[model samples]
Target: MEWRWNAVFLVSFGVVWAAMTTAKPVSSLDPADAETRMLAALEDQYAHDPGNAVLARSLAETYLDLGRPGLAIAALRAGDPANLENPMVAHRLAQAYEASGRVLDAYATADLALARCARALGTADAPSGTPVPRFACDARQHMALSTHQEALGHMLEWGIADPARDARTEVAYDLALRRASIASAR
Candidate 1:
């Protein structure tokens, strides 16, 4: 039921990601050379600031853009514990795992990312007219929720029941998905 809506969201998200990745910028330099330069810069930046969540995320994204999910996974994993717990990093790591054909790992990581997002956003509901968080929390939460739903769908498809499943989580996720859908439609 809810999973059907989740499936639609996941497929749309994947299509957007694929389209974005495939769209090359019109540049005087060769596209490959530009991407290579961007990758080199990201690697250097990440090397200097391994604990920086933003750098780690950027490095992982670059690796993924270059179709090297293995490198992306390594980049995401080789960071500070606090940084590694970042929802965005976890989201990217899950994507990397999926790209590399590691379905179980991807599902686990997406679940973790969803948990991290819930923690970051807190349990207390915001007032109806409250301003959105300043740190891109909305986008982070959306990414985490969509990825987890997608991964959970995959697990069910594979006949695996997640041992971590709970009724509370399912209800919360459904509400969150509804809110996200409403927000996006605005």
Candidate 2:
């Protein structure tokens, strides 16, 4: 009876070990290979839902991850213009623009996204006791911070002083600060 119990335990352990070894963790894949696989999956989804804003945005992000900012821009542009108002879409587009060295465009896109976020949050004078929502303000602040960081990154990449870079950075910092203050006020 003891031997029979031992045999069952060994078989169960072997099955568990086989399952573990057969199922590879996604993190174990090479970064490049994983990215390629993700891009292919995103592309397949996009093909099935050509007008899907979410899929388009995800595809653009994957392209950006693959260091193909130009393709990211194209993918984003191909999506419905109405979806551009989505803060996430706008933010990703700005990132792609920044990656492609279009600093002004990136700043403008980021600014537009921030504005949309603010608008979504309702007017600034919205009742004194009203609870301030979190997501839009936080997203706006993130977009501003990202724009500022991207500007600095571009400056470092180009190895040259851009007169507008400082101005953009200042504006971004101010925007971020304002957003944070608003959040705190609530």
Candidate 3:
């Protein structure tokens, strides 16, 4: 009995000591470090697939989330300029521009996104037999209002007195509000 007790105590102490030496405390792990590592991984992926809109968008979005809007803009621009079929890519680029204090760029990008959104939602005229699929339209519709609002905000903040500013701003805000209502109903 005495020998068994001594063996168990030794085993327990050894286990405790191993755990203490091997395990890091949860609080000691830096979240920023993890985020930086993830950003690096994303950059590697983007480098390998520069033409991939989804990968580029993800990388740019991650950079934007990390408060590195310049990096985000660079990622978005790395893709083909004419291949912004994914409206959200343009939307994210617009957001990065806004965050980086490039209001004019933001307005232009958001306007481009809005046009893509319109086409995706079937609001733009197309061949009579070809309508946008319901699911596809629904997927893109959610972002329409936000994109319009972004455009309007950027235009307002551009601080230039264009002759068409009043009409354009009104139209943008009206569309944004109308889309918001439509979105809420869904």
Candidate 4:
């Protein structure tokens, strides 16, 4: 038992040390180069350990920087529910949908993901243990909302924000209004 405890302590200390010094950082808008490479390494680890749902989710997130929605979707697909997919996979799916020019599908998926986050918010893990807050825990809600909102913005800005003043004016206006509404509510 003594030897086992020492081994565990040593391993835990090593992990903590690495995490403190070498672990990658995350941000909502921009990530540093070191962070990017760390994400890539994490993705590779997920690929090696296919059964780790948390790893799968992380791998999907990391690939977002690579502008590879398809691969991100692939990784998130492998993630399990519970703590993994309920939210992120949905958002990434929306990204993939949008990239594929499936605007309606993209909106639908993003909505569902945000809804899931909303549903999970402050509920299961509330301080007072009250019912779920009907939205995400605080950070989670904002993150979900941000991703969906950003996706909508991207959809609007995808084609230079240039509109066809001729026949497609109505279509352009509709899209612009939708994006504007989403952004304003942000």
lDDT of each: 0.68, 0.66, 0.67, 0.58
* Candidate rank order under TM-score: 3, 1, 2, 4
Error of 1 at 163 (Å): 22
lDDT of 2 by residue, 1-186 (tens): 999999999999999999999997754437578666776788878777767767877888878776788888887787677667666677788778877867667777876665566555665523335344323545445545444544544444444334334455455446546665776678
Residue lDDT tens for model 4, 101-176:
5566666777666555655664342234333433233564545555564545555545422222233435544655
TM-score of 2: 0.54
- Give the clashing pairs for model 4: 118-135, 121-135, 121-136, 121-137, 123-132
lDDT of 3 by residue, 68-87 (tens): 89888887887666436566
lDDT of 2 at 138: 56
In candidate 3 the C-alpha lDDT for residue 123 amounts to 60
**lDDT measured at residue 160 in model 2 versus the true structure, 0 to 100:** 31
> What's the distance in Å from true for residue 143, model 3?
4.0
By TM-score, the better pick of 2 and 4 is 2
- Weakest 10 consecutive residues, lDDT, candidate 2? 125-134
Q: What lDDT would candidate 4 get against the real structure? A: 0.58
Question: Model 2 Cα RMSD, Å?
Answer: 15.6
